[model samples]
Target: MSASTHIAVVGLGYVGLPLAMALAEHYPTIGYDLNEKRIRALRQHQDHTQEVTAEQLKNSALELTNNCQDLVRANVYIMTVPTPVDSNHTPDLSPLLTASEAIGGLLKQGDVVIYESTVYPGATEGICADTLEQASGLKLNQDFYLGYSPERINPGDKVNTLQTIVKVVAGSTSETADFINGIYQKIIPAGTHIAPSIEVAEAAKAIENTQRDINIAFMNELSMMFHEMNIDVLDVIAAASTKWNFLPFKPGLVGGHCIGVDPYYLIHQSQQHGYFPQLITTARRLNENMSSYVSERILKLMALHSKHIVKSRILILGVTFKENCPDLRNTRVVEIKDQLERYHARVDICDPWADSTDLKQEYGIELTQNPRADSYDLVILAVAHDCFKEDAYTPQNFSREDGLVFDLKGLLPKNEVNARL
Candidate 1:
């Protein structure tokens, strides 16, 4: 890894933008994305994702581009494209494949290609490597090399950032692994872990999110059971957490780009290898069903309060997949809105972090700029954004005297909400 080694980072989203920013501090880094609007926004220091601040973007020396021609000058290409699931919950490699083809055409001799996208084992070697080979007219290892270092980016997380988290890097060969590890070690102060092989690194990345999905699914199941028993799951969790080795996982809508989607990638690969992953599959099913479960709970409370189902005006406090972020990818909050709409209930969502245009474009749900006070039949705290936690944003402020309050994330006090899950 030379100081002269120019690096091109493909796909400048949540993972790529921060990473490219960090790398630019040490190397000549170029951030590339296919979306022209995204490149324009990055240049103007306006990140709709809100993962990178305007000050950081304006100060960084990193080059931002939407044209593929701008990437040919780079000596090392690191792909951070998204690996999402399709409608059938299968691994959709279109983005990864397309990125590979684009990067492949720009590959030069001795120029290494490393993938930071989450994928099943062998995807780098089997799918991406082959695509690179075909597009570049070069053979793997002989002409150029390949590497895999899965991205561990948590959106809206300020503490554990790209430089703080330990990076896992693997390559097609030992030399390639060391070269890639050395490059990442330059920016990652927390250091890098060189996996034995690319497949192990891929497997590790896939399971990291799958494990969280499974654990959260267990908590979700307990929440459902405790609901039936008229017990508070959070109380039981609090008591059990007193133990020396208890895993403290809270139950809520498990939605995001990673946990909600990664399990299906592992499930797809496992089934391809002739092994049906029952536990992983079931965990995903349970987590996916949480939105409907919450919707049912809200309707039940509405009925118990003698409120009409069809004519009720319900307000959801948040819509982003997680708190303090504008990332709406795979957010299960829409499921609740959809289910509530089935009963002809008017659903209005408000999230300070979310982009109104994105919400309207992606989910077809208009973002309510100002939610009226004391104007709802029910109020649900959906994502628990920091803005929603202030003393001014209580359930009583939004709901009428007899109106119900449902706390999905359990952020509200026990006495404040009529029900929680």
Candidate 2:
């Protein structure tokens, strides 16, 4: 079955690009994204995301395209579209639905449409299934089949990659499930686990991030409690990590495509079924307010140093959502900058990994490449990128004499920084 199968990975961003590259090693595969510029860049071995290197892109046989008609030849269509939240943090399924609607028109008998996008339970079986069926004029399970294999792609993570992570797959029918599992097995050396139903697979993906969000929320709560007691949260975390069975989750701004947004999908789905999850709701609220919390903490530190808030010079080191990555989706650092700016503080953000155009367009804030030494009233190390490592660079050098420096990620030398979260 694998030898004759042709694969088309739709929405080729971070997830689809890697998956298509891996699948191309074993099967005939083409990657399609709507962005023509991105397609042109990928074809020339230039990936702005930096998830895949120039050498890897240049060597891979994965065909890249922006035209939808190019996807009609593949028997397997994997949806790696982004499933983000709106301004209100509600699940935005427009990207998912639009991709599904497009793929449905090209569906043929015995074709399998597998979703790699993260969504709430029953989303693939209910919403996406209906969309495909309506557009294709075919009955699911009787004509075309559906599958769900949630993508486990970690942006900027090189160690636990696509082939290393275990894949969870499910299908509308038993034979379909087995077929999907086998196909993923060839690409994933860590192997695949076949779920009993599509809903179970979808729900598994939702909670994987929700669990991390709740755990990090607990850590954030601890950071707040320890702050009130005049204790450092990183010191406390270091001590607690010595235990045999402790889960080592640090406290900081939780943002990105998965942890920041996946929980809301489950929360929205649960509410539809008349079940309001208290723990999940509280965690989401607390994580969302971390920006305000960090902003207030910085202001308090500035006040203690006899510095006024208005027209104060501030430098924010690293603005990307996470360290060592250019992905800026739902970054909480912007919120921190906004909260501080409301008090008339001038905040200059510098991130080597992020694009200057994207940072300015997303937040209307310009990116500073080379910050002058000892020129700022205060400095905040928000993202722990490799360039700003304590061994490589000094964040204190950016702060003026007697100025305060706060290490949000606990990456700086403890003695150099005044406080840490």
Candidate 1 ranges with C-alpha deviation above 4 Å: 1-3
lDDT of 2: 0.91
Model 1 score (lDDT) = 0.91
Which residue pairs clash in candidate 2?
Answer: none
Q: Which ten residues in a row have the lowest lDDT in candidate 1?
A: 387-396
Q: Each candidate's TM vs. the true structure?
A: 0.98, 0.98
Q: Residue-wise lDDT of candidate 1 within 1-421, one digit each (tens)?
A: 3346899999999999989999999889999999999999889999887778899999999999999899998989999999999999989999999889988998888889999999999899998999999999999988899999999999998998888999999998899899899889999999999999999999999999999999999999999999899999999999999999999999999888999998888999999999998999999999989998999899889989899979799999989999888899999998999999999999889888889999999888898888888999999999988778785666678888788999998888899899999
Candidate 2 lDDT over 1-421, as tens digits, reads 2337999999888899999999999989999999998899999999888888999998998988999999999999999999999999899999999999999999988899999999999899898999999999988988888899999989999998999999999999998999899889999999899999999999999999999999999999999999999998888888999999999899999999999999999999999999999999999999999999999999888888799989998899999999999998889999988888899999888888889988888878789988888889889999999888753356877888878899999887799798888
